[model samples]
Every structure is written in C-alpha cells, then in structure tokens.
Target: MLKRVEKAQQKWGGSHTVIDNWLNERQELIVLYCKIAGFSPYEKKDQSLPEPSQIQAFCQILMDYLSAGHFEVYDDIAKACEKKGLESQQLANTIYPRISDTTDIALDFNDKYAEVDAEDLLVGFDNDLSVMGEALEARFALEDELIDNLYSNHAD
Candidate 1:
C-alpha cells in the first residue's frame, strides 16, 4: 500500500497543489493504516488492537481524506472535464461510478470503525482492515487514472 502511494507520488508529484496535497493526505492515511494493521516497519510490539484514541484518530483522518476527495477534488476535476469537452467528460463519467464504489467501501469502513468501541471491534477488525486496505489500493489506482486522464494533457 505504501509502495503504491509512493509510485503515485512519483507519477503525479508536482502536478498541482491540489493533487500534491491529496497525495500527502493519502500517504498519511496509509501510514496510519499500516501502523494500526501491524504491518508497519515500526509496528508496535503489542498484537492487540490499538487504543481507541489511536483508531479514532485514524478514522478522523480517513473521513477527512474521503471528504476532500469527493467534495473538492472530484468536483474540480469533473468541472474541468466538462470544460475540456466530451472525451474527457466521457472518461470521467465512466470512472466516477467505479470510484464511487471504492468510496462506498471506504465509507463503510469509516462507519464501522468510527462508531464502535475498541472491544467491539476485536472480532472482525483484522478482516475489516484487510478489506479497507484492498479498497484503498483500488481507489488509489482509479484516482491515479483520473489524474492522468484528466490532468495529463495540462496541469490545473
């Protein structure tokens, strides 16, 4: 996941302030995810789920990242595509539904994690995180394609 994020940064870095900041936020979310999922290089010695505060913090960042992508980034890109004419608009229309699928997966994760007690999460947390990781990976790929397709001809 971290590797995917790095690859994205390299591909899209310095493209625009909006994209750069979005990528940075993505990296932050990935680091927090790795730490919580016990896959980080600096993984804590303990095996149990992290403290509620830690998970809550991750959830907060997750929600913010999701919100920004949907509200700000996608809106701006869609409008740009509209202006760029039908080819861009068609590509965006095709991609947006797929992206929204990933968004729903992420929102489900956020809803489950952000609302529950730590003790309540113990039964399915690992599975949930695994699914979240996979969804995020798919999301990153789709988002990269969106940026490439929409912004490659010209940076905004």
Candidate 2:
C-alpha cells in the first residue's frame, strides 16, 4: 500500500493520488477485517462460513465507507471534467452513469447483505473498490494522453 501510495503520489502529483491511497487504505482495512474474522479470499466455494448477522454493524460501516469513497472520486472526476472544457460534457455524462451504478451497487450490497456477519459476505466489495481505482487511474492516464495529443496536433 505504501508503494502504491508513493507511486500514485508521483503519478498524479497530489490530491488524486491521496484519494487513491485513501481507497487503497479501505481495501487494506477490509482485508484486515477478513483476517480478524478468519476468512480467506481464497476459501473453498463449497465451504460455508457463519452468517453475517453477527457483525451487521461492521458490515454497515464498511459499506458506507466504500460507498463514500466511490462517490468522492466520482465528484472529483466531475469537477475535473467541468474544468477540462466544454468538450467534456459528453464524457461527464457517460461517467456520471457509471458513478451512479457504483453508488447503486454500494447501496444494494449494503441492503442485501444487511444481515451478513463478519464471515458471511462475498469479497466482491474489495474487488469493486479495486475496479474503481483502476477506472480512476485510467482517467489519470487520460490527462497524459490529452496532453500528448495536444502537443502532437500543435506540431502538425
């Protein structure tokens, strides 16, 4: 996580990298919680663990945390798009829906798994966070792409 944080810091300069690190921290926290509850992401599919009702409070907290993290990044992207130019309207619209989906997933998971205990829920929340991070990283990469494109066009 530290290495990723440093890489993000170097790559994105400041705030976005901090956001990336923040998301990464949540993932680490979830992993630690999983360890505390004695489950592995690699557990056998057929193996059954205890129900989630035993740790409903913790699950809710995690759900909220993840949901907020996602939305925060979404907000950041929206602000960036607004500043990028009038050309960003279409991109913002497309990305907004994706962010909406992310929020919906968070809410749905929180509701559906409301009864889940420490060991009962799926590991997909962690995966979803990772995917979100990657998506944001792609946006960061696009900053570089656009810059290069601008330079190339100017050279033409």
* Clashes (N, CA, C under 3 Å) per candidate: 0, 3
State the lDDT of candidate 2 residue by residue for 74-105, as single tens digits: 46555655666555545557555554555565
Q: After superposition, how far is residue 81 of candidate 1 from its true place, in Å?
A: 1.4
On a 0 to 100 scale, what is the lDDT of residue 13 in model 1? Answer: 89
Q: What is the C-alpha lDDT of each candidate?
A: 0.83, 0.49
- In model 1, the worst 10-residue window by lDDT is 114-123
Error of 1 at 83 (Å): 2.3
lDDT of 2 at 30: 51
Candidate 1: the clashing residue pairs are: none
lDDT of 1 at 30: 90
TM-score of each: 0.88, 0.48
Q: After best superposition, candidate 1 residue 5: deviation in angstroms? A: 2.4
Q: At residue 13, what lDDT does model 2 achieve?
A: 46
